[model samples]
Target: MQTRVLKYFLTVAELNNITQAAERLHITQPTLSRQIMELEKELGVKLFDREKRQMHLNKAGVLFQQRAMTMITVLDQTKNELLAVNDQLSGTINIGMVESAVSDFMMRAVQKFQEKYPDVRFNIFDGDGDTLRERLDQGLCDLVALIQPIEAAKYNYFPLPVQEKWGLIMRKDDPLAKRKAIMAHDLYQLPLVVGRRNIVRDDITDTLKIDLNKLDWRVIINLPENAKQLVLSGKYYHFGIYGVYQKYHDERLAFVPFSPTKTTGHLLAWRKNVQLTPAVEKFIQFVADQTTHKKI
Candidate 1:
């Protein structure tokens, strides 16, 4: 149950190769293997399924991985809190964010906060809404920025003033690129790509009153760059928010808004009832004040 051993176990679980994990951990392969073996013995259960040159998690290992992640996150936060106890203005603030136009405002707040508290440091993690929420629930991050339609009961949040419009990113030469806005029927039968999140697809169906199953979902993209590449190939249109395309516009691509103006708001959230470190609290307040005064 040592923290070091739990880290080793998690590293192995992630990499799935003993040699790779050992190299990353800066430990000998024999030592890493012995530690994992001792950990299994202590827990009284086998954790991995061994195959040639591969180690996959068993049922017990999967369960342990969840608990171990929570433990490690809590321990890291506790350590930061203890270290910052003597210095009220300086500590680590971990934040998770989804991409949005509000990022500039968030960064502005962070810059101002650090100017006042020079010793405070920030760690930023980026992901989709679900991944960000998982990190927050596990106590790995102090705050998260997410798109709207989140479960409001789960966390305290502040809505930012930015509205992200949903649109189509297509090749400049495409016929739809000449139009000011696109409609649901405009995309019908067209090969399209979108974010991998099920919620997004569901929302599109509900908003546009179009059957997603009827449309050709050519690709489900997990990365923005991949989505852009697919659209740039001139065969597909990328369904994404306006900010994303505007942030990284390609000469060959054009972003057209939705006809009905589909939009989602941005929100910053933190776990309800979790004790906040001074640095985290102060940073949140700074964001709040900035949002109140600035028109982002």
Candidate 2:
């Protein structure tokens, strides 16, 4: 089957209108229609249903769409790799990173990498570790920096020198803030403000054996800034890494490291056995070296 036909099919399937897809593809309607017809005949299946001048994908088309998307992604990635091989770090690198890593390691690494390869571009997506991992697995990001280790077999993980120390963030006047180190049980008594449950909460709670249902958990925030805001209000306490905690170390907020049981490690991950281009290789080395030197 011709790749062009698959491309035409995918465009039509996405737009659900031949005219719109053709216009978007910068091809005339007749040419696009012919390509789609040829694909249908070659595949021996009707990919779409026509009803009242609208297009709806049939069951086969739905399945084919998934495969076609993967094919296109692989083809695009191949093209990029080839371009990168020409000693031009000019292509984009999509990165997903947890909130803490964004402030701690990612910022420095990206700054240095950009300085070294000014022609290279970056697309950053910041979220919790689990969300970052999900984006990495779905091919949405070229790499991910996570605070937690990824146990998935498909991913190859590199431990950064920066080990994350969990901390309890609260108002300076809060009783827990006066303590040198906060215990997990101490957090249970306060109204806990934590990031999304799936991302950081469950892992920390599981490690500490803190029952979420039994604790005075106040809010489940998804953004790092929101967690900071809540902790600064003096009513709620947030649990996060020192990197994030340090961001709000003003007079209104105080952060104490959570007792040793709560600390987690940071790691970088990408698909196993996948060949990385020179640009990505340089970035990986740069991150490794920076983290090692900073001892973060």
Candidate 3:
């Protein structure tokens, strides 16, 4: 079968509605239906059972879909590899970055990589560590950078140049800002604004083990900027990695490192076992070199 026909079939299978699939593929429903009919005729097997307005995949169709999806994935990867081999580092790199890393580190890496290889393109998605990990597993991102331990065994990771530390960001006038270091118990007393439950939060929670009901936890915002704004109002305590709050540390905001006796946050990650393109490999090497040099 033609690749185009297989694509159409896959699209239809995904939506399970020819009309909807047609709209997605930007084709007429009649044309899509005719193509499917021709495909079934050539294969000598019924792929779908149409009942009024609804459609369901037949046994053969279900099996075919499994194989077809694998084929499509391989073909797409092969195409990307071929393009990369042709010295066209022009394809997109989908990256999922934690909010803290995006401000300085990720942007610097992307800028430096793009300058050296101007043809390379990028698409960045931001989220907490757990969300980033989920996206990486779902094949949505080529790489993810976050501040959390990677527990998955199927993936490999390289450490970035920076190590992160957890901190409490509050208004300059806040009484807690007077302390050189804040403790976990101190945080528990305040209305804390933290990221949603992710690896990072889990680690913190596991370490703290404080009663949720007793703590006056306020809103849980996703982006660091929003959390900073909330903390700047002098009513909430923003709890996140130091790097994320560092940018906004000014006369209005004060950031105090969480007491070492309390808890400390670290940065690490896991990535899918996909073949790294030349550009990706180079970027990885740069990160490795930076990390090693910093250690020295």
Task: In angstroms, give how far residue 65 of model 3 lies from its true place.
Answer: 19
Clashing pairs for model 1 are: none
Task: Kindly list the per-residue Cα lDDT of model 2 for residues 1-296, writing each as its tens digit.
Answer: 87788888988998899899989999998998888888889889999998765788999999999889878776776676677887567666778877674456677788888988997777788887667776677776788887764565788777876666778877888877789987667766778777774645677777777767777767877667766767777778777777776665577887788665476777888887777867777788878777677733
Evaluated at residue 129, the lDDT of candidate 1 is 81
Once fitted onto the true fold, the runs of candidate 3 whose alpha carbons sit more than 4 angstroms away are 1-79, 87-90, 101-103, 205-213, 261-272, 294-296
TM-score computed on alpha carbons, candidate 1:
0.85
lDDT of 1 by residue, 1-296 (tens): 79999999999999999999999999999999999999999999999999987999999999999999889878877888777776557879999887767676677778888888898888888777888888899888899988887877989999877788898998999989999999888888999887777776678668878766678888886657757777888988888888788766678889999878889888989999988998888888888877898733
Reference-based lDDT, each prediction: 0.85, 0.76, 0.73
Specify the poorest-scoring 10-residue window by lDDT in model 3.
261-270
> Where in model 1 is the C-alpha error above 4 Å?
10-33, 49-66, 196-214
Shift in Å, residue 74, candidate 1:
2.2
Per-residue lDDT for 245 in model 1? 88
Candidate 2 or 3, higher lDDT? 2
Alpha-carbon TM-score of each model against the true structure: 0.85, 0.68, 0.66
* Candidate 2 C-alpha error for residue 57, in Å: 17
